[model samples]
Target: MSVALDGVGFVHANGHRALTGISLSAGAGERLAVIGPSGAGKTTLMRVLGAALHPVEGRVAVLDVDPWKLSPSALRKLRARIATVHQAPPIAPRLRVVTAVLSGRLGEWTLPRAIASLLHPSDIAGAHEALTRVSLQDRLFDRCDRLSGGQLQRVGVARAMYQRPALLLADEPVSALDPTLADATLRELVAQSEATGATFIASLHAVDLALHWFPRIVGMREGRVVFDRPRDEVTQEMLTALYANEHTAQGAADSAVPMHLAVCRA
Candidate 1:
C-alpha cells in the first residue's frame, strides 16, 4: 500500500476538532478523489496524509512507513518522496518561476548545489520541460508577482511534477482555473502520475471533476467520511445526500439532480 490511515483523529491547538476516525487506504499507483463541502476536514486530511500534521490519535502509514515514527532525517527523506500541490501554492511573489520549480528538489540536493541553484537555477531545461506541461514554458523566468491566479496555480503543479514524487497529493489543485484549464491540468497531472506509477490522491470541491478523473471516490462530511465507493457505484442520490446540510434533507435530496448540478458548478 502507498497510503493508509486507521482511526485517525486530530484536534487543533484552539480546541477545534479537525478530523475524526478517518480510515482510508490507497494502493500503489491508485487514484482517489475525496469530495465534500467546506470544513469537511479535507485539507486537514491532506496535511495528515502528507505528514504535515501529526494525528492526536491513531496511525498513518505513507509509502509503507509511518512518518511520525521515523527520525527527523528519516522523515525528511520520506517527505521527499511525497509531494503536495496545495490549493494556494505558497510561493514568494518575487521568486522566479525557475527557482520555484527547482526548489522541489532542495530537500534532496546538496547544500552548495541548493544555494547555487537558488542564486542561479542550475536546471533551466528541466524547469522549462515541467512548465511546458502546464503551458507555462514562456513564463519560465518571469517573477511570480506578474502572473495571474490561475497561472500561479499551474506553476505549483509544474513544481510538483518536477519533484517526481512516488506519492502525489493535491488539495483543490485547480480551483482557480477556468473549466478548460481545469480539465487539461487535471488530465496532465493524472496522466503523469500514472506514467510514473505514483499513487495520486486529491481533495476536490467539484464533484464532476472528481467523478470524471478518479476511479475511487470518498465523501467526507463534518469531519467524517459519509461514503467511500468506486466511481461506477457512486450514485447521484448519494452525492446529493453527502452535500446536503441539515436544512437540505427535506429540500435538496428530494430532487437529487439539481443538488448534484449545484455541486458540480461549485
Candidate 2:
C-alpha cells in the first residue's frame, strides 16, 4: 500500500497558505523524514498525509482511496489504519500512562467497550507490552503529568504503537528531549514500527538525526518542497543551505550539548 499526493495544496481558514502544490508518496515500511525550519509547513503537510486535513486543491490517495472523497464513517475507518503522534504529548495529564496508551485501541473497539475500558483499561497486557517496548513499563501507572518530557513523549509513542497502524505520522516526536533520550526514543519508534511493516513519516528539525535514521529526506521551505532524496544523497552543505538564516544549526548544536553542562549553564 502507498500514500500519494498529487499537486496537493492547502490554505488555512485564516488565509495562510500552508502547502502549495506539494506532491509526494511513501510505500509501506519506508522511513521518510521531512526536515525544515519552523513554520515551513512540515506539520501541515504531515496532517494532509495523515488524512486529518483535506487539501483545497489536488488529490490524495491512501491505498487507492481518496481521503477527501471518503464519507465521515469511511474517513474514521481509514484513520484507524494511520496514527499520528504530535510534538507535545497529547495524553491527559491526569490520566494514568497505561490508560492513555490503551486508548489507542479505541478506534477498533465499540463505544461501550471503550467507555467501559476507561474505568478498567481493557488491554492491560497490550499496554504493558507497549510500555516495555519504549522502556517505560515501570511507569505504566504513573500520571502523565508526573513523567518527564522525554518519558511523556515515549508514552505517546507507545500509544501509537498499540494502534498497529499501517502508517505512522510523527511531528517532532523527539524535539523536547535531550540528545541521548531523543536518539533512544527515535530508535525505539523506528524499530517498533518496522517490526510491523508500517511506514513512517516523521517531521524533524535536527538534520543530523534525520540523516542518521531515515533512508529518505524531504526538505521544505516556506510551504514548498525544495529537496527530496535518499540519505546518501543529502549532504551537510545541503542541510545548512536549506535552513540558512534560521537557527537550525544552533538547535542541532544545542541537542549535541551535554545536558549536565547545559543545566549548569542555566
Candidate 3:
C-alpha cells in the first residue's frame, strides 16, 4: 500500500476531537477523493495521511514506513516522499515563483545546495516545466505576492508535482479556484499521479467534482467514515445520509446529484 491508516485518531491541543476510528488503504496509482460538509475532519484526515500530524491512536504508514516511529531526520526523509498540497500555498510573499517551486527539492538536496537555490534558483527548466503543467509558466519569475489566491494554490500544486512524491495528498487544493480553473487543475493533478504511478488522494468540498474525478469515493461525517465505495456504487441516498446535518442538510441536498448520471457525464 502507498498509504495506509488503521484505527487512526487525532485531537487538537485544545481538546477538540477531530478524527476517530478511521481505517483506509490505497495502492500505487489509485485515485481517491474524500468528500463531506465543512468541519467533517477532512483536513485532519489529510494531515494524518501526509505524515504532518502523528496520530495519537493507531498507526499511519506512507510508502511502507511508520512515520512516527522514525527519528527526526528519518522522518524528514520519509516526508520527502509524501507531498501535501495545502489549501494555502505557504510560500513566502516576497519569494520569486521559480524559487518557491524549486524549494520542492530542498528536502532531497544538500544543505549548501538548498541554500544556494534559494539565492539563485539552479533548476529554472524544471521549475518552468512544473509551472507549465498548471499554465503558469509565464509567471515563473513573478513575486508570489503578485499572484491571486487561486494562482498561489496552483503554485502549490506545481511544487508538489515537481517534488514527484510517491504519495500525494491535497486538502482542498482547488477551493480558491473558480469552477473552470478548478476542473482544469484537478485534471492536471490526476493526470500527473497516473503518469507517474503515484497514489493521489484529495479532500474536496465540491461533491460533483469529487464524484466526477475519482474512481473511489470515501464519504466522511463527524470524524468517521460514513461510506467507502466505488464511484458507480455511490448513490444520492448515500450522499444525503453522509452529509445530513441540521445546518448543512439544505447545502448538501443542493450538491447531491444522481451518482449514475455523474459518472456518465464525467
Candidate 4:
C-alpha cells in the first residue's frame, strides 16, 4: 500500500480534534478523491497521509515507512518520496518559477548543490519540462508574486511533477482555477500519476470534478469517513449526508436529491 492509516486520530494544540478513527488505505497507482465540506478533516487527512502531521493515536505507514518511528534523517528520506501540493502554493514572492520548480529536488540534492542550484538554476530544461505539462512554461522566468492565484497553484503542480514522488497528495488544488483550467490541471495531475504509477489523492470541494476524474471516492464529514466507494456507486443521498449539519435547520434529511446534489449522478 502506498498509504495506510490505522485508527488514526489527531488533536490540535488548542484541544480541538481534527480527525478520529481515520482508517484508510490506498494502493500504488490508485487515484482517489476526498470530498467534503469545510472543516470536515479533509485537509487533516491529507496532512497525515503526506506525513506532515503525525497522528496522536494511530499508526501511519507512508511508502512503507512509519514517519514518526523513523530516525530524523530516515524520516526526511522517506518524505522525499512523497509530494504534497497545498491549497496555497508555498512559493516565495521573489523566486522565479524555474527556481520554485527545481526546489522539488532539494530533498534529494546535497546541501552545496542545492544552494548553488538556488543561486543559478542549472535544471532549466527540467523545470521547463515540468511547467510545460501544466501549460506554465511561459511563466518560467516570471516571479511568483506576479502570478495569479490559479497560476501559482499550477506552479505547485509543476513542482510536484518534478519531484517524481511515489505518493502525491493535493489539498484543494483546483480551488482557484476556472472550470476549464481546473479540469485541465486535474487531467495533468492524473496523467503524471498514471505515467509514473504513483498514488494520487486529492481533497476537493468540487464534487463534479472529483466524480469525473477519480475512480474512487472517499467522503468525509465531521472528522470521519462517511463513505468510501467507487465513483459510480456514490449517490446523491450519500453526498447530502456527507455535507449534513445537525445545527442547521436544513439537514440532510430535509435535503432533496437530483436537486442540490444532481452532479453526483452525472
Q: What is the lDDT of candidate 2?
A: 0.84
Candidate 2, clashing residue pairs?
Answer: none
The candidate 1 region of ten consecutive residues with least summed lDDT is 257-266
Residue range 111-205, candidate 3, lDDT tens digits: 99998998889999999999998999999999999999999999999999999988989999999999998999999998889889999999988
TM-score of 3: 0.95
Cα lDDT, all candidates: 0.88, 0.84, 0.89, 0.87
Top candidate when judged by TM-score against the true structure: 3
Better of 2 and 4 by TM-score: 4
Q: What is the alpha-carbon RMSD of candidate 4 to the true structure?
A: 3.3
Q: Compared to the true structure, candidate 2 yields what TM-score?
A: 0.91
Greater TM-score among 3 and 4 belongs to 3
lDDT winner, 2 or 3: 3
Clashing pairs in 3: none
The candidate 3 region of ten consecutive residues with least summed lDDT is 257-266
- Least lDDT summed over 10 consecutive residues: which range in candidate 4? 249-258
Q: Which parts of model 1 have CA positions greater than 4 angstroms off?
A: 246-266
Task: Give me candidate 4's TM-score against the actual structure.
Answer: 0.92
Please provide, for model 1 over 1-266, each residue's C-alpha lDDT reduced to its tens digit, 9 standing for 90 to 100: 99999999999999999899999999999999998878899999999999999999889999999999899999999999988999899999999999999998888999999999988899999999999999999998999999999999999999999999999999999999998999899998998898899999999887778877888889998899999987767777787678776444324334433433334331
